[model samples]
Target: MESLEQKSSIARFLDNVFKLSENNTTVKTEILAGVTTFMTMAYILVVNANILGEAGMDKPAVFVATALSAFVGSLVMGLVANYPIACAPGMGLNAFFTYTVVIQMNHTWQFALCAVFIEGIIFILLTLTNVREAIIDCIPPLLKHAVTAGIGLFIAFIGMINTGLVKVGGAAVTLGSMRDPLVLLTVVGLIIAAILMSKNVKGAFLLAMIITSALGMVSGLITIPKGIISAVPSIEPVFMKAFSVSTSEIFSFDMVVVVFTFLFVNLFDTVGCLVGVASKGNLLNADGTLPRAKQALLADAIGTTAGAVLGVSTVSSYVESSAGISQGGRTGLTATTTGILFLASLFFAPIFTAIPAQATGPILILVGVLMASSVLQLNFSDPTDAIPAFLTFVMMPLSYSIANGIMFGMISYTILKLVTGQKEKVNKALIIISILFVCKFIFL
Candidate 1:
C-alpha cells in the first residue's frame, strides 16, 4: 500500500510539473508548439558565443551567459505574460554589437554592455508609460504587413548564410552554386514547406524541418562530427560580476548615438514581434491592449538588462513564437517548456553544436516563408495602403532594417496623402511619428 501511494504521489507531481490539466489536447499542443518555436530561433543561443568568441571571450563564459540569459528571460516572459512567446538576444542587435560597436567604433565589450542596460531601462520606461502602444498604433497598417514580411526575408537571409547557400564578398555577396548538395537540400526543404503549408498541415514548419534534416543526413550533406550528439552535465552558479563602463567613452556623443540606436531597434523589434505574435495567438482583445502587455514588455526589458550584465547584446522577443501559437499554443506553459529546454541546453552545448547549420537553416527559411504570407492581408484597394505596403515590403529586404522600412513607408504614406488632398485621413499620432522619424534620421 505504501509503494502504491508513493507511485501515485510521484505521478501527481509530474503532472503538475508538466501542467497536464484536464485538457490533454491543450497540454500536448502547447508542448509541441514550444518545441517547434525553440527549433526555429535556437541559433541565437550560439550565435552570440560565436561573435564573442571571435572577440576574445572564452567559450565557457559565453556558453554559460547565453544559456543563463535565455533560460531566465524566457522563464520570466512565460510566467509573467502567461503567453508562450520566448525571449533571447536579438539577431540584429548582436550584429550591431559585434560589427558596429566592437569593430567599427572600436569600443570594449563592457561599454557595449552598458549601452544594452541603458537601452533596456529606457524600454521599461516606454512600456510603463504605455508609450509603446502609441508608437505601435501610429504604424500604418500597410507598414505592419511589410515589417512582418521583411522580418521573414531577414530570417531567410540568415538561414541562407548558415546553410552556405550564400556568402559575403568585398563589393557584393554571391549565391552558392545550385549544384551543391546542401543547396539542393535547402531547395527540397522549401518545396516541402510550401506543400505542407498549402495542405494546411499542423506544425508544417516543424515537419518540413524534420524531413529536410533527415534527407540532408541521408544524402551526406549534413555531417555530424563525433561526440556532437552527446549531452553534457548541468551548469553551476558563478559569482555575479559588476557591470563596468569607461566614463570617457560612455560620455562620448558617438557612444550615446550607438547605444540609442541599439535601444531603438530593439524596442521596435520587440514591439513588432509582440504585436505579430499576440495577434496570431488571439491574446489581444477587440481593443488594442494585449491581456498582459506590461508583463511581456517587462520580461523583455529584464532579459535585455540581464543579457547586457552577462556581457552580451540586447535580448528581445522573437516573431518565431508565432509558429508555436499557430500550432495551438494558448498559455505560458509553452514558454515555460521552451525555457526548460534552454536551461537544459547549458549542459548540452555539444548537442546544439553538433547540429550542422545546414540542418537548421532550412527550418528558418521555412518559417520565413510562412511569415511572409501576412502580406496578403493588407488592403491593397486603397492606393494609400498599396503604396506604403509596397515601399515597406521592398525596403525591408533592401535596406536590411525593419524599423527603417517602417519609417520610410510611413513617411511616404503621410507625404502622399498630404500632397493628394487627402490630408484629413492622416492621424495626429501618425504625423508625430513621421516627424520624429525625420528628426531622428537627420539630427540624431
Candidate 2:
C-alpha cells in the first residue's frame, strides 16, 4: 500500500537521524505527538490575531501572519535545533505589546514591532556569542522554578479574564456575574477539561475545547462560521505597518523598556519551558543541558524577528509543547510535523478563528494546572530561596506581569542574600540585571 511504503522510507530516515528506537518513539508516534501539540496550541492563531488586532492591525492579516510565523519558527526548531519545541507568538508578550505599548504608551504598533525586531536581533547576537548560555546559567535555579509557577498563575489569570470569570475592579478583581449563562458555560467547560485531564485522556485539553465550543454554538453563545476555509489575506496591511517605524525608535527610552521586557520574559519563559519539557522527553544531556542549546536559541531568535517582520509579536518556545513531549515525542520530526500542520492551517482560517475565546480559556486554565507542578521543585525549608520564590509566585499573577515578578523576586533575593549573610550566592549577572530593572523603574 502507498501508506505502508511511505511510512517505511520516512520511518527509516527518522530512525536514522532522530534515533527513533533509541528515544522509544517511531515516525508514527512522532506524527501523532505533533498533531497532539498543534491541537493544544492551535488557539494561538485566533487569539494572537485578536490581541494584535486590538492594536489596530488588520485581523485577517494578523491571522495569516501568526500562522506563517508559527510554521517557519517550528520548521527551524525542527531542522536546526532538532528538538520537539514548537515556537509561536507568545501570550504574555503580546499582551504587553498591545496593552502596555500601543495602548498605555500610545505608541504605534509599528513601533512595537520595531522594538521586537531589535530585541530579536539582540537575542541572535547573544546566541552567536554564547552569551545566552552564560546568562541562563547565571539565573538562580530556585528563581527559574518560580518563573514556571509564576507563568502558571499568569496563564490562569488570562484564562479567567477571558471567560469573564474574573473582572477587574478599581482596586482589585472581583468575580463576574455567575447568574449569567456565559459565566456558567465557562465553569462547565473548565470542569470538563479538568475531568478529562485527570483521566489521562489523549488530547484531553483539545477535546474539552471542542466540546465546549460546540455547546457554546448550540446555546447561541458563539457565532457559527458559514464556512471552514477562507481566501488568504494579504500581508500588506500588517507587514507594511510593521516596517514603517523608523530605525530611530530603537534609541527611544520607551522602546528600550518595551524591548527589554520582551527579552526578559522571553528568556526566562523559554528557559523554564525547555527545562521542564526537555526532561520529560528525555532530550537532556548527561550534564542536564539541552543539546544544541545555541542552535535552539538561534532558531527562537530568528522566529521572533521573522514573526515581527511578518506582522506578529515576539516568538518563543511554547510550554504547551509539553503536551506532545509527554505523548512520547522525543525527536525533531514531531516539531517538523507540527510546522507542516501550521502551514496547512493557513487555508482553514475561518474554522480556527471561529473558536470563541471562552472555549480557549478553559484550555489555558488546564495548561496552567500542568505548569503549576513546577512548584514541587521549590525548597521552602530554605528561607532565602523560599522567600523570593514565593514572592514571584504571588506577584506574577497579582501584578499581571511576568517581568514585574521576575524583577521583584530578583531584587528581594539579592537583598535577602545580603542581609542573611549569603552574599556569596549572588552572582554578578543577577546583580547587573537587578540593577538594570531598578534603573528601568527609576529612569523610565
Candidate 3:
C-alpha cells in the first residue's frame, strides 16, 4: 500500500499527463479529442511531402516545412482563440497550388507562394476591418449548415480515394471491389470505429487505426520496408523562403483575380470550419459568437502568411480538428497537445508513413460523419428554410465545392423569398453576399 504523500504525488502526475486542470473532465476530453484529431490528419505530413517532392521541392524541405507550419500554426491558433483548433496548409489549396498555379498558370512555385502571401495579408486586413465577420453573418443559417455537411462529405470522399476504394474514371467515377486487400482493411477499420463509437469507447478513432494497421501488417496487406522507418529521424530544417515579387508584377489584372479568388474561397472555408468546430465544442457564447473570434481569424491569417513563407499554400483551420472536439475537447490544452504531436511527427514521419491509408481512412470517414451532424441543427419545418438548406446540402457534394454550393443556395433562397413577396425578411448583408457571388462567378 502506498503512503498518502506517494498517492498524492501519483495523482499529480496523472493529472499532468491528462492535462487535468481544475476542470479535469474538460481537459481529459480535450486530450482524447486531440489525439483522435491527430490520428485523422497524420496522413497530411506524408501526403504533403509527396506532393511537394513531385513539385520539385526537396523531400526534407517539404517534411520540415509541413511539420513546422502545422505545429506553429496550431499553437498560435490555440493561444489566440483559446479553442481546440488546429491549422495547416489546407489539402485543397495545396492541390490548387500544384495543379492550377504551377502547372496550368505556368508559374514558378515561388510565384505561387507570392500569391498565397498576398492573399493572406489581404485576409488579415479584411478580418481586422470586420469584413470577414460581416460576410459570415450574411450567410443564412441553413446555407451554413449545408456548407458544413458538404465539407463532411468532401472529406469522406477524399478518404475513400486515399484508401483506393474510389478511383477517377474516363467517363465517371466508380467504386473499387472489396476484394482488394486495402479496401477490405478499410472496411474493417470502419467497422471497428463504428462499433467502438457506438459503445461510447474512448480513443475510438486511434484504436481503430492502430488495430487495422497491425492487422494489415500481419496479414501481408501492408509491406514494411527496412531502413525507411528509421529515415524519419533525418528530416532536416526548412528555412523560411520569402516570396519576392514586384508590386506591379503581383498587381497585374490576372494576378489580382487570382488573389481575390483565393481570398474569397479561403475566407469562406475558414468561416465554415470555425462555425462547425465551435458548434461541436459548444464554444460559442449566448450571442452566437465564439470567444476571441477575431483572434482566431488573426491566427488563421498569420498561418496562411507563414505557409507562404514556408513555400506552401494557404493555411486554415482544419475541420478534422472537430474530431477532437466531438470527443469532448473544449480548451486550448487540446490544441497544445495537438501542436506537440505535430512537432513530434518530425522525428516519426517514417512511422506515420508506414501507416497504410486503409488504417487512417476510417478516421476521416468517422470525422465526416461526426461533422455532418450539424444538419440536425437546421429547422426543416418551414419551406422557406428547408429549400435553401436542401439546396446547399445537395449542392456541396454534387458540385464538389463549398463555394459553389453556397452561391447557388443563396441565389435560390433570395429569389424564392423575393418572388414570394417576402423581401422584408432578407438582410442587406445577404444581398451583398449574393451579388458578390454572382459577380465572382460571372466576371472574376
Q: Candidates 2 and 3: which is better by TM-score?
A: 3
Candidate 2, position 126, lDDT: 88
Every model's Cα RMSD, please? 4.0, 3.0, 3.5
TM-score of 3: 0.89
Which parts of model 3 have CA positions greater than 4 angstroms off?
A: 1-24, 169-171, 225-238, 246-248
Maximum-lDDT candidate? 2
lDDT of 1 by residue, 1-444 (tens): 999999788656535654445325366677788887777767776777788655545556766677778777888987777778888777777788777887787877666777888887788788789887677766655566666776677667777877778877646678887898777787788788778878988877778777877787677777544553444322222112215566777788977897779877776677777766675455656655566677888899888878777766778887767667766777777787777878777766665555556656766676677667878878888887788877876776666666777777888899888888897768898888788889888976
Question: 1-444 in candidate 3: lDDT tens per residue?
Answer: 469889778657645643456434554576677777777777778778777665566667777677778887788886666668888888777777778767777766666778888898988898899888777666665666666776777667778888988877746678878788889899998899899889988877778888998999899998763533344433333344434666676767767766787888888778877865776566666555555778888888998888877766788888778777767777666776787888887767667667888987887788788777878878788787778877876766666566666777788788777888898868888887888888888886
Per-residue accuracy of model 2 over 100-208 as CA lDDT, tens digit each: 9999999999999988888989999989999877666666767777877777777778788988999987569999899978888899999998899889886676678
TM-score, per-candidate, Cα-based: 0.85, 0.87, 0.89
Choose 1 or 2, whichever is better by lDDT.
2
Where in model 2 is the C-alpha error above 4 Å?
17-19, 26-29, 98-107, 240-261, 276-290, 326-329
For TM-score, the strongest prediction is 3
Question: How much is 230 displaced in model 1, in angstroms?
Answer: 7.3
